[model samples]
Target chain A: MVANIRDKAAIVGVANTAFSKDSGVSELSLAVQAIKGACDDAGIHPREIDGFATFTLDTNDEIEVARALGCGDLTFWGRSHYGGGAATGSLHQAVMAVATGMAECVAVFRALNGRSGHRYSQGVSGELLTADAIHWGWYTPYGLLTPASWTAMITQRWMHRTGVTKEAMFEVARCTREYAVSNPNAFFHGQPLDRDTYFNARMIADPLQLFDCCQESDGGSAIIVTTPQRARDLKQPVVTVKGVAQASAQGQEQMTSFYRDEISDVSEHRIAAGDCYEMSGLRPSDIDAAVIYDAFTPNVLLQLEAWDFCKFGEAGDFVLDGNLRPDGRLPTNTHGGQLSEAYIHGVNGLVEATRLVRGQSVNQPGKQVDHALVTSGVGIPTGGAILGKLD
Target chain B: MTPEEQKAFEDRIYAYVGVKVCERTAAKDAVNPAMIRHWAEAMGDTNPAYTDETWAANSRRGKTIAPPAMMYAWNQEGFTVTRGRASDPQTDMVELFNEYGFTGVLGTNVTQEYFKEVSPGDTLYLEMEIDSISERKATARGIGYFFETLATFSDQNGEKVGTQRFRVLKFIPQEQPTAATGDDKLEVPTRIPSPRGHDNGWWWQAVDEGKLLIQRCKRCQVLRHPPRPMCGECQSLEWDSIESGMEGEVISYTCLRHPAIPGYPKDPVCAVIKLAEGTNLVANIVGCDYDDVFIGMKLKGRIEQVDEKTTLPQFYPA
Candidate 1:
């Protein structure tokens, strides 16, 4: 029996810090500030939040967060693996906790001093000795250390099979950067990347130029999830969680999946997309806007195909046809994405999802966004969420 | 000296090519977590893996390892070496360049190859070899010898851990322009082996003595450009070293432009030459016109001084 908690749990408030290269503060401070801002937006006292959700890789702990917020005894706390793939999983945990009567109010957040602190852009530099490091040792010896290098291998094969050029990547950057110009919170605001400038950027790893990779940023963002009854009692409008899902394929290995027969198979995202549609009882056409996880732009196009937004080899055409624009059939990432705004993992997208549903986004499209689909990064063990406006 | 006479003088010095000028040296202390902490503090990197104990214990990396960029720190000799050997080749070369009015010196580029992570308590030692020296070249910075030095790092167990190829320019501060080289002259650069571990360092040692050495597995008789400790087919560590006639042919080549490696040509020709010994090795395609670099071109390998400490095996069109 499907003990569905559809629309029972909703995100009543969303808040984000100014995204930038250096936050000049600790990650704990950023998290606490964002959570406080979210509680204020929801018109709820800090003591009311009884649960918290964050990434497993986050530097902050729930106990510290609760202590900082002066919240009562926690009723629920959870985390998920995979970088941005865990963004929607956080909301999934929050919604479950609220729907099951385990917690009355939950704060789902992601915080990082990614640029001012330990930059993930450096790739695997001997963090510690682990089984994963042992596997990477086989290739890292040959200078294949960065994420761009690992992604390049998959990109080369994909380009050979399907005719996707570097232009497809620039299109995503161009769209997001163009939108970011108006978004005050976006790091790339007012610095729209032109075609010539995009092409002129150095190629860090082959097929993936400097513009193709996402910006490493420092910021915090939080969504306050609560029971629909309690959320309706609050002053702000409610953006209810319609459906969310997480999935991983059989031959999943964190980021490097070249060992499998189909190296470029992004089936895990397909599974999550199917689950989201099934749980929400909605089709792709019902999704008015999309907040996709774009750590690298090529993966963005790949996820579009995996989620069935476009045909297998037609993602390039879909992007080139101005389908991702604000007035297109499905206006996507109007708040810009990781490639332009900031990489707060997936919380920035979730924050944008809430805004699109509430009709408060900085770059809100002319069309009504009754439903927004937010996705995590496309690697295995990924997740997604479908948030709907509660009339 | 006129540009032509300077060229002939450089040719005369090239005959003294295969000189093992510097001996092997070891660092003062082994790697430690304290060094990692000090480095992280200076750089303001509060990565818990480098400092916090509780996090590293639960993290994927079981214990803390030294930063990859800290490879050179393991065996860094202080400002003045306590065990500085007399008759240092680098000093002699610097003195020679100073005599020739080429006094300016600057570090250009560094390429490092790490085979394994270095952990606390693991001691490392590096033996450096001067890989190559450029003919007199003019740069905006000055005119100088672009010295390329290759250092082979090994653990206390004698396992080859990594290698660092560092290039430096010892040039003279000149205002006037100097005439360029011959049309067939390959851009002068520092040439070092892409990979040379303990088993193959002796081949480079032989090359420094003006001998083009090849490694042959005694068990399998298969030859390899990089003289590995073991044979690919037979898995035997024992091998025989033989001197080649330094003759080869270019099998493939590429012209690099961006991510410019300093001291080398802005547009350099990198060639993979198959020796007469049936082994293939990568070397700078020097002494040829940039457009004229082609596959299957007959070539010969020669020894050239890279720095005061090391010599490298280079190939030119035969």
Candidate 2:
């Protein structure tokens, strides 16, 4: 059965540390700061937050975050895997906790020093030669092992089958950069990229240029989720949890799902999108804004297609038309995205969605943002959610 | 066959056979596509994608590709004299005399996985750690010998690539009296001089000189000539050079011989040695030739300039 979007659990607060290339702060410190900021923003004591959700890749443990924030007792604590895909999953867990009366108010956060602390851009090493890595032995010996390179394989095939041009991929980057230009918290604020710059950027993989990839930043973000009644008493305007869903397809593996029947198809993400739209009882047109996961620019485009914002292979054209701009049809990532904003594994994206519904986004759309869609990582078991203005 | 008799036979064999230990070195800037390709070509592979970038770009497989097994093509850096380095001919001959003294060593292939494809430009840092060593008693050719070693290979980023399990054969010479066996008489032959190169003299010299060496083709910049003279690269002449530095990590390694080599020892051990200088040298490692020669073991070179006219280099534990 579908849940009422306007009457579900609400977001009581949202907080984030200043995004920077080097925060000079430890991951644990960032997590604590965001959690404290969130509690303060919600006008609630830290002890009231009994539920927690975070990314699996986060180094900050729940116990550590809890102890630092002086959390009295945690009734629920969980982590979602698949890197950026965990963004909405965190919120999903929090909403589930609130809906079930497991916890009154839940805190979901992601903190990291991705750029300065541990960079994932470096190539593979002998450490990958384990029994698990042996699967790549079949292809790596032939030179195809980096994350971007692996994704490129699918991107190339997707373009081949769908006739999506490189220009179409650039539109996604262009829009995100435009949104980032106005977002003070975005890493690329005031420095939007152009199509020419995007095209001329250095290629990390065949189709993935440096600009096409997401930015790595050091920062933290947290959101407070509570019941609608509790949200009305909090300091910030309530943004109700509309709908959420997570899905993993049959042939899922880490990065090597090459054995799948079709490379261009992300049936898993499409399935999750369907569930999100169904449970929310909201059509694609009802969403006033979105915080689509942009770990890679092409993924954003692919996600648009998967979500039925447009037909498959038409996302490039949809983006090129400026339909996603703030003044256009649906503004996205008003605080920028992983591509421009700090990528705290997509948790920041959820925080942005909450801001949109609260009418607090720096790049706020011309219309009153009543609903927003947010997605987690792609190409893996992923999750998504829809947020709406509480009645 | 009795345990006491076996102990006595192994003790007599140990008096002859010796041991050597190798040290380790840091492997930085070891991963490169060109270097990997050079090593692969030397191993008798003809895949055009490894060498010709233009061909690779045009090929259906996309860019240039390194063979999965090519990581094991270089020599490891490190050395230690574990045993048998100082044995005289009498002791060595005695070690080979008793059939029951030969403890067999066998190298097994565990598992390997590749994530990103390795190309020519990628740089790899590698480190190796010795996992463990064990000794066992065995009888070979009616002679008895003691145990051997097993080693594991770990890459620079702390990934394990391969492992080696090895053992040594020791026999008492004919002159050495053996405990009587019921109705079983043994005859030991006189020690004959092993062929000059066949005795692995070149390898021993390289270890002594602190320089690893691989036979390379002077004409084509190709390396070959470990087991034979045909160039795997350009099929040209087999010229050789003393490889500089004991600073390469074992990308991959094997401890067993294939079924092809005729008269090959029942459990002969070999490794595809990726050298610090980006060349892959294949040879039957000696000195501490136990199953312990892991994938990431660091090895150094010992050079022996034979007969003022020719110089030979070999690798030992670094």
Instruction: For candidate 2, give the lDDT of residue A162.
Output: 73
How close to the true structure is residue B33 of candidate 2, measured as C-alpha lDDT? 68
| Per-residue alpha-carbon lDDT of candidate 1 for residues B1-318, written as tens digits (9 for 90 to 100) | 896978875775454344444555666888888888888888888888777767778889777777777788877766666777455566676667777777777677776778877777888888877777765555656766676677788888888888887777777775543454345332333322223445555765676688887888888887764555777679988889777887987654544432343433334455546778777655566667656865568998788764434465667788
Q: Scored by Cα lDDT, where does model 2 land? A: 0.66
Across residues A165-255, which tens digit of lDDT does each residue of candidate 1 receive? 8888888889988889888888888898999999998766666788888889999999999988888899677899888888888657666
Number of the top lDDT candidate: 1
The DockQ for candidate 2, computed on C-alphas, is 0.02
| The 10-residue segment with the lowest total lDDT in model 2 chain B | B257-266
Model 1 alpha-carbon miss at residue B274, Å: 25
Q: Model 2 TM-score? A: 0.56
lDDT of 2 by residue, B153-219 (tens): 3455545545443433343323333555456543222111122343244643554455555556667
